[model samples]
Target: MSAKTATARPDTSKPPKKGSLHHVVQVHYLFTLPILIMYLVFFIVPMFMGIFYSFTDWSGLSSQFNFVGFDNYGKIFQDDDFINALLFNLKYTVALVIGTLVVSLILALLMNQKIPFRTGFRSIFFFPAVLSGITVGLIWNELFLKVVPVFGQTLGIDILSKSMLGNATTAFWAVLIVNLWQGCATPTVLLIAGLQSVPKDLYEAATIDGANAWQRFKAITVPFLLPIINIVIITTTKAGLTIFDYIKALTDGGPNKATRAVGLLIYNDAMQGGKFSYAVAESMILFILVAIVSFFTIKGTSNKEAGDA
Candidate 1:
């Protein structure tokens, strides 16, 4: 019989300390607390308060307010201007989204190619994005008022002197055109960045696979750029919904409120008309509409991403 010695086994069965997890959680909370607090203060709290005010008869300036309980919301639905403004805003949002995406995509593709003066072209494309909406509106107003007439005179057309914003139909189209022109630049820049980030090797591989130009673009470029495209769509949609400056400067909800957006209507109700609670209700409704539309849009995009993956 030999003496058997048992080797000391390594301690592999010890449980992790609860204190370690607690410390990690504490560290994460510490890092995230400031952002959470800021969001609550700036966004969450204000949003809830707005919702509350939407149900009240608060005149915005007065400290006293009465709870009206959905009457304001009911009035918003009944108001013809609110209905028209909502419709106009919807039309504008749809047109702007489609126009901006189409134009930006085309510009991005062109700029991605081995073209001369690419830097200059890019600067020209993106320059409008840096300008304030009010500035863009003012500049375009002058162009429509002055430059168009001069051009029209050179071409011998008298109709060019007519104010675009003076007619209901014309004012709507004018706002849409101005929005598309000024807004396309940012998305163009974003799409260009997305395009550049796509691997060149993927295109080469597609070419090797006998893929045509359109096929390569459809399969490779678009798929790779879908994430950025979603971002651009969300951003542009929100911007379109919240647009106030250009509309204020250009039409001021004129032509019998033909070009008035929900934002403008809300402003008119609150400041111009002194229907503060009603404006809050209108704002809340607009906010909900925006949130619902955006949610659906994002969900659809996310589903596409999942399917692609």
Candidate 2:
């Protein structure tokens, strides 16, 4: 009665032999080793070094420095320029995200329709994305400074006759419009791809069920595009927060520092003022803010997507 048959279990105890497929597969990892090393050396190392410097008083050119604990971080909060920059960044991010999302989604929907010359239209809209932000800004800056005034004079319109960048009240809108023009292109392409991925059958069924255009969009299109929308939100938020080239080219944070973005501030402080450690501290705060915003955006979208599923 005590003599029971034992079933033999397959053995995974032995390691793969040399020259085995498993070993060969592992060798593939070696192909990526160089890239990994480069990333560690160039990016990770510098990031840590910057963080270390942020806690010290390094004038960037100085060979010697002193650690000042949280002095930089504490000073940043008390700085009025920093506060103004932070507020402007928040305003810019909100406007950029909203405008870009809405305009991109609209353009995507239009492009997705069976319209004449859709490909040409798509190309035209996406062309702006290929141009550098600085280039675009410079172009638009000239247009606002020169071309628009001519049109305004011809039409006898006062507001249109002046360079918007030269006015504090209109500078924000001008910057926003320029950013939206270039920024909408990539998001439009993304939303188009997302739109194409949605099952046509769902729309057809919804139509058959007497769902109106808005209803169908709300119930089906929105859910399918949630992931792409989330991506657009996070990316645009980051771009808006770290905006520099455009401001540099367009206004240089001009019109009484009305549009001094955090990125530009960091650049000016580090390079122009030689306050490298302070700039690093600003960058760290910017990084943390971006991380928090991205985390919440992803978490909220993922939850909604999961609930829909």
Candidate 2: what lDDT?
A: 0.90
How close to the true structure is residue 207 of candidate 2, measured as C-alpha lDDT? 97
Compose the digit string of candidate 1's lDDT tens values, residues 151-188: 76888876565767778887877787788888899899
Q: Candidate 2 residues 207-292, lDDT tens each?
A: 99999999999999998898889989989999999999899999999889988999989988988866999999999999999999
Give me the runs in candidate 1 sitting further than 4 Å from their true place.
Answer: 1-42, 61-64, 152-161, 301-309
For every candidate structure, what is the RMSD over all alpha carbons to the true structure, in angstroms?
Answer: 7.4, 5.6
Which residue pairs overlap in candidate 2's backbone? none
Poorly placed runs, candidate 2 (over 4 Å): 1-18, 21-26, 154-158, 304-309
Tell me the TM-score of each prediction against the true structure.
0.82, 0.88
- Number of colliding residue pairs in each model: 0, 0
Which 10 consecutive positions of candidate 2 have the poorest summed lDDT? 1-10
